[model samples]
Structures are given as structure tokens and as C-alpha cells.
Target: MGKNVNFTLLTMLYLFIYIVASPNSTIDKNALLAFKAQITSNPNKILAKNWSQETPFCNWIWIGITCGKRHQRVRGLNLANMGLGGIIAKEIDGLSFLRSLIISENSFYGFFPDEMGNLSQLQEIEM
Candidate 1:
């Protein structure tokens, strides 16, 4: 019985460590904030205001954002019908996990980046 109790205690401690040390716990917070800043600087309200770092962007609940089933990286960005007008930043290519990009019904006038094809997960690219 004592051995079992010790195992349980060790398991709990390991879980606590994992929770506190995981990158997802903090990386997402900072990344989401940067994304919010980018959207705010954009001309249109393509990104809704509710997606700040203070708000946990759960994959199932996030608006205009989608994550991979496993890695949960930013996999899709749906900015259609939002009237956003500008070139997609070259920095956006940094979202390497991106798969779907929808920018229809808006006015973004700029040359499409050739690097966009580098997104290996990309399946749909709607302009």
C-alpha cells in the first residue's frame, strides 16, 4: 500500500512539472498576443477583438483560426469577408503549419509571396 501511495504521489508531481514547463502554456500566450497586435494594425477588423491573449484561443472555440489535431499549430486562417486591405506580410510565412488561407471578399492588393508555397500543410489558398 505504501508503494502504491508513493507512485501516485510521484505521478502527481510529474504532472505538475509538465503543466508548468510545457511551451504551450506560455508560447501560445505570447504568440496570440503578437497575432492580435498584427490584426489591430491592419486596416480592417479581420481578426475579431475577442482573441486576445487574455482569452484562451481553444482550437475548437477560436474564431477564424484553426489548429492541427495534434501539434495545435496555427493551421488555418479564414479572413474572408472582413474587408481587410493590404499585402499579407512576409512574416506570415512564419506560420509554417498553416494549411488553409482564405482571403476572399476583401481588398488586399499586393504581390503574393512566392514563399507561400513553402507552407507544406497548405491545401487551400483562396484569394
Candidate 2:
């Protein structure tokens, strides 16, 4: 009985550590903020007001930022038709676990960043 209790405690401790030390915890937040910074105009002001530093990016009310189930890593970003205009920065590559990207109907002018090739998990992108 004592051994079983010790094993349960150890398992719980490991889970706690894994949750606290998740690698993608803050990377998505930073990447989203960087992306937001590039937007010069937001006619709808969706990202401008919600994607603030005061709240976690996961909790932000932005339309298309999806978080992973286990680790809260960024999984998808679809910033379509928000009337945004800006350069897509290379810093976006920091979202290593990102699976989808859809920035259609927006007016982001500039060559797409080469760093986007680093997103190995990216399965779809419509820009």
C-alpha cells in the first residue's frame, strides 16, 4: 500500500513538472504578440484590444488562434479578412508546433518569410 501511494505521488509530481515546464508555453504568446506588432491597421480592432500582454494568449478572444490540447502550443492561426496590413515577420517561425495558417483576404504586403519553412508541423497554409 505504501509503495502504491509513493508511485501515485511520484506520477502526480511528474505531471505537475511537465505542465509547468512545457516548452511551447510562452513561445506561442511571444509569436502572436510579434505578429500583432506588425499589423499597422486593424479596422475591426479585434487583435488590438484582445491580444494584450495583460492576458494569456490562449485566453485572447482573437478569432483564429488555436491552442494544442496537451501543451497549449499554438496549433493554427487564421487571421482572415480583418482588414490588417503589414509585413509578415520571420518571428512567426517560433510557433514550431503550428499546423495551419490562413491569412487570406488581408492586405499583408511583403515577401513571405523564409523562416516559415521551419514549421515542420505545418500541414496547411492559405495566404
Candidate 3:
């Protein structure tokens, strides 16, 4: 009985650690989806056709997304001149590892989300 109790406790500890330490790619994916949700117009259907849960967000490099080599985190986003128009989503800040963002030459309206300031790793932004 004592051995079983100890084993159960140890198993529970490991599961807790795994849940706490594991990186969640969903956060970045959801953030991107939130941004997509705000897009009023995507003339080329680039995002509409590509940005879906069926494909991993890290695999979206062709559509102006860049992911970190070491992890699945988004590092850069270049949505320039794709004829996209919409408000920027406040959830954009969920991309904690984002380093560069370029959305220039587009028709995006509304104030930029204040939540973007939460991106500590952000180094460059062009709007």
C-alpha cells in the first residue's frame, strides 16, 4: 500500500510538471486566428484559405509568417501589401516571441491594439 501511494504521488508530480512546463503552440495559433478574424477583406484569399486549424501555424511561412527555429513560436510577420484591410486584434500580444512585424501599405483601420506592448521580444514594427 505504501509503495502504491508513493508511486501515485510521483506520477501526479510528473504530470503536473509536464502540464506547467510544456510550450503551448495553440496560444500563437489562436492569436493569429484572432487577427484573421478581424480582417474585413482579404482580396487574394491568402489568409482565408491558408490560416486554418487544419495546418499548423508554423507551417504558414509562405503566407508571411516566420517561426523560431528552436521552438514553434512566431518570430516575424510580414503582411505587407496583400491588400488586407481590418483592425488589428488585441490578441496579437499573445505572440510572446514575435520579433518583427510588417503590415505596411495596407488599409487597416482603427487604433492599434495596446496589448501589442506586451510583446517584449518585439524589435521592429512597420505599420
Cα lDDT tens digits, model 3, 18-116, are 576345577888899999999999999999988887787786544889998766689999999999999999999989999999999999999978998
Q: Which candidate achieves the best lDDT against the true structure?
A: 3
Full candidate order by lDDT, most accurate first: 3, 2, 1
- lDDT (CA) for every model shown? 0.66, 0.84, 0.88
> TM-score: which is higher, 2 or 3?
2
Q: Could you list the CA RMSD of all candidates, in the order they appear?
A: 4.3, 2.7, 4.8
Which is better, 1 or 3, measured by TM-score? 3
What's the lDDT for residue 15 in model 1? 90
Model 1: residue 108 alpha-carbon error in angstroms: 0.6
Deviation of model 1 at 86, angstroms: 1.7
Q: Candidate 2 regions off by >4 Å? A: 1-23
Worst 10-residue lDDT window for candidate 1 reads 37-46
Off by over 4 Å in 1: 1-48
Per-residue CA lDDT of model 2 for 60-106, tens digit only, reads: 36568888767677888988888888988788999998999999998
Model 1's TM-score against the true structure: 0.63
Native-to-model Cα distance after best TM-score fit, residue 2 in candidate 1, in Å: 9.2
